[model samples]
Every structure is written in C-alpha cells, then in structure tokens.
Target: MARHIYACPLRWSDMDAFGHVNNVVFLRYLEEARIDFMFTQAAEAGAGEFAGGSVVARHEIDYRRPLVHRPEPVTVETRVTRIGGASLTVAYEIKDTAADGTETVYVQASTVVVPYDLAEGRPRRISPVEREFLSRFMDEEVVAV
Candidate 1:
C-alpha cells in the first residue's frame, strides 16, 4: 500500500520549556499532515469535496519519544486504516529516518474523520469517489495507539 508522506517543519515556538516538542503541538502537526493528505492531494485526484467540509470525530495518539526542534523537517507518514460508511480512520507516524535506514518514531496516531455536508449541516457518508481515493492509501497494519 502507498502512504501519503509530508515533510513537516519544526518551529522554534513548537518547543516546550523542557526543550522537546510539546505534546499538544503534535496534534497540530497531525492536522497539518492530514489536511495535506485529505485536502491537497485528494483534491488533485477529484475528491476535492472532502476539502469543503470534514470533522474530526476522534483522535488517538501515542507519544513514543521526545522530539527536539531541529532544522530538518520531520516526516509524517499517513495511511488509511479503516473506511466506514460515514467515517474513515487515518493513521500516522511522525518519525525521522537516518542515513543508515534506522527510523526513530516520535508519535503514532490515528484520527476518525467524518465528511460533512456544509449546506445541509450534518455528517455525510463517504462517496464512491472519496472511498476510491482513500483506498489507494490503505494498509492493514494500523498503529496500535
């Protein structure tokens, strides 16, 4: 399966007094990556409707290691874990890969997102187009957060 990869830059302000990236900021990182995947990339594939409206039904995250702010961007890899009738689960890993091919994962998380009908003011089911787009990034191994 393919994964949507985003290079997320770390800002100095994202660091906590203790010097590591604050736990809360990781949520923002996830949002940035998710928006790129569901909105930017999906839109290019004709599933732009997802950009119109979507709600985060739930978020589950596990902070595996402390991440300090650095000049290089961290990699956030996103994949589809489960796609339901009205919602879909996307899993993510925030990590750095060394030249030696070792990976250091700082966070593992998943978010349940529901498409919404902005005009109707309610949640909507996944359309065939959206489902087809999401299926391209499907993976069986979901991070157990």
Candidate 2:
C-alpha cells in the first residue's frame, strides 16, 4: 500500500515518570505527524483550511510498546488509509531506531476527521476541489464510507 510518512525528533516533555516516552504523548506525536503530512509535506492532499472547521468523528489508538528516552531521536510515520467525500481516515506509527523487537512499534493510531460548516456547526460534504485534492492519499481505489 502507498503511504505518507512524516519524521520528527522526540522532545524532553515526551518523557514520563518511568523515564520513557509516556503513552499519552504518543497520541500527540501522531497528531503532529497528521497535521504536517496533510498541510505541509503534502498540501495537495488537504481539503481546505481545516484548522477551525474540522471535526474528529472517531479516533482509535493502540500502543505496541514503551519508548525509552535516549539521546537520539524517534520518528513518527503517518499515512491516510482511506478517504471519503467528507471524511478522511488517517493512521500513524511511532518508532525508535535503536529499539528492537515489537518495541519497534511505539504507537499506532487511527482517526476519522470530517469537514464541518463553521457557521452552522454541522457536517458538510467536501467541495469538489477539496475532494479531488484529498483523493491522492487513497490506494488508487476509492472506498465507500
């Protein structure tokens, strides 16, 4: 499957009481990766200005292992699994290069985001241009929502 991956360094705040990357922080890393991929690296895949007009309809996160805080950096990988007219489902993976075993998969997350009418505060169908733009993330075949 085709995928979009974004990499970033781990920050000091990402550590927890155990001196390893906290579980909750992984979700935040996923969020940052999603935003970067959709807006910067692949702006062509974004619908429109979703900062204040987007709504997250559903979210799922799976933690595979604990990330130890090391002097080196960790990377977050993100990709869009599928996209509908109004909704897009995105996935993420966080990993540390030094880690071995399943500890490789530090985190995984899936999120469904929908465009909304900022004025009416209700869900809305994506615009034609936006729909065309977002299709780039798909697997060459459109999936029904």
Candidate 3:
C-alpha cells in the first residue's frame, strides 16, 4: 500500500473575502492532485489510457480547517480506497506538515471516478493495466464512506 503525494500551490485568488481559501477552490486543488496522480503518474506507470477519458462520478469532502494563502505549497496525499469493476474511489488529505512532523489537515475528501470510452461514448470496465497501476497506491485501511 502506498500514497501519492502532490504539492499544491496556493494562489492569492483562492482566498475568499473572509481571508481563507474559498470552499469551491478546494475542489480545484483536489482536481489538480487527482490529475497529477491519475494522469501523469499513472501514464508513467503504463496506465496512460486514464488520461484519455475519466470522469468524476461523485465527491465527498469534509473541510477540516481554514487555510490562508501561503507561498509554500500544501501537501495532498491521495490513496486508493476502493476499486469497483467500472469505478474507483480515491481518498485525499490536503495538509501542511511542520518541521516537527505535525500535520495540519485542511481537508479530507474522496472522489469516485469512472473510466470512459470517449470514442464509444460510454463508461468502461477497469482495464488490467489501469487496475495494476491503481493497486500500487491502494490502502486497505482507508475506506471511504
């Protein structure tokens, strides 16, 4: 079991009038991290087809703390929680780790993604290669519900 780590930069525009990152912007952060994981990293692992067409079927997010804009990037750790026949669920934690090794989690979320056949215009089953790539990051203990 492993976790994919992404360094997500914070932009000034992500801040809301209240001075913390807006709720909606967190979705974008998650997208960036998910893309890095499922597209870039997966392709390198021989699951390049995921980049062709994968759609988010559902998102479950819990905002744990407010995050103000900062120059340093926040850490987004992603892991596969469940893999269905046609869809997979990924869990994420957006956080900052201090020098002392303490972690301040800003958000905990999960997303259900379905592979799609763009040419055929419909969903598809999880390919063996794709499943193999995703299995590397699967964590049995982190069940998303």
lDDT of each prediction vs. the true structure?
Answer: 0.92, 0.71, 0.92
lDDT of 2 by residue, 1-145 (tens): 5566666667887888888888788777777776776555544445446654777788898888777766666677666677787788877777755534444777778889887789987888766666555565665566646
Better of 1 and 2 by TM-score: 1
- Which residue pairs show backbone clashes in model 1? none
Going through the candidates in the order shown, the clash numbers are: 0, 0, 0
Regions of candidate 1 where Cα sits further than 4 Å from its true position: 141-145
Task: Give the Cα RMSD of candidate 1.
Answer: 3.3
Can you give the TM-score per candidate against the true fold? Answer: 0.95, 0.77, 0.95
Q: Put the candidates in lDDT order, highest first.
A: 1, 3, 2
Error of 2 at 34 (Å): 1.3
Question: What would the TM-score be for candidate 1 when compared with the true structure?
Answer: 0.95
Best candidate according to TM-score:
3
Better candidate number, 1 or 3, judged by TM-score: 3
lDDT (tens digit, per residue) of candidate 3 on 19-72: 999999999999999999999999999899889999999999999999999899
| Model 1 clashing-pair count | 0
Ranking by TM-score: 3, 1, 2
Give the clashing residue pairs of candidate 3, or none.
Answer: none
